[model samples]
Target: MDFWNRNRAKLAEKRRLRAARLQKKSNPSSAAEYQEKCKEASRTYNAKRLLAFKKREKRAEAAEVKHGRKEANRRQDQRETARDYKVEYELMKSGAEDAFRERVMHAMWNPAPGEYRIQFSDGSYKYFD
Candidate 1:
């Protein structure tokens, strides 16, 4: 109980000092100074925030440009691949036709006795009457 009483007095003294400090800060001159400090702090904070926003926007634009280039390259690669495949198919088809023509010419030029060449629908040749 004695300790509590002693502490209570100390608490009251501390409260008085805090109140006096608050009262001093609430004076017109001190209030103006405090407002100016607050304004300066707010300005700095807003400037920092604006700079960060601009940096983020720049990064986003760069990323979009990079993505666009990548997409264009991908499309170009696909087109090239398709063109290559078409050319390969055409070359293979021409080679097959040439081979078939050569075989027919050879058969016509060298006919055996009572043997004739017959062509099937599946691009095959057989010996028949």
Candidate 2:
């Protein structure tokens, strides 16, 4: 397989292995049990997201009332800026770029970028971003 397919396969295998390891501790006897666990996870994740959004809205409104909507928005924007900065930190790592790279495209104009390896005389290769 080519690099992109190989990389995707590696990632998929890693996910499967991790899932197997995790599931061993909480083995559900049936598919229905697994489905229930998945639904509960989805529900919990959504509830947390909703709570966060509500908190941000309240903070924004409070800021608007005390100061001005512009300042409130600016503050909220700063928080988002910080969050994005943390998310982008992965880009600094050579291996982490693959996680952020857009892999799913309806129009396959080109294959995704691959980390090309430079091989030395002794058959050892150096990985580069």
Most accurate candidate by TM-score: 1
Model 2 vs. true fold: TM? 0.33
Expressed as tens digits, the lDDT of each residue in 73-114 for candidate 1 is 999998986674454345334556565554343333226775
RMSD of each: 14.5, 29.9
By lDDT, the best candidate is 1
> Alpha carbon lDDT of residue 121, candidate 1?
44
Q: What is the lDDT of candidate 1?
A: 0.70
The Cα RMSD of model 1 versus the native structure comes to 14.5
What's the lDDT of the predicted structure labeled candidate 2? 0.62
Worst 10 residues of 2 by lDDT: 103-112
Q: Pairs clashing in candidate 2?
A: none
Q: Count the backbone clashes (under 3 Å) in each candidate.
A: 0, 0
Task: Provide the overall lDDT of each model, using Cα atoms, as 2-decimal numbers.
Answer: 0.70, 0.62
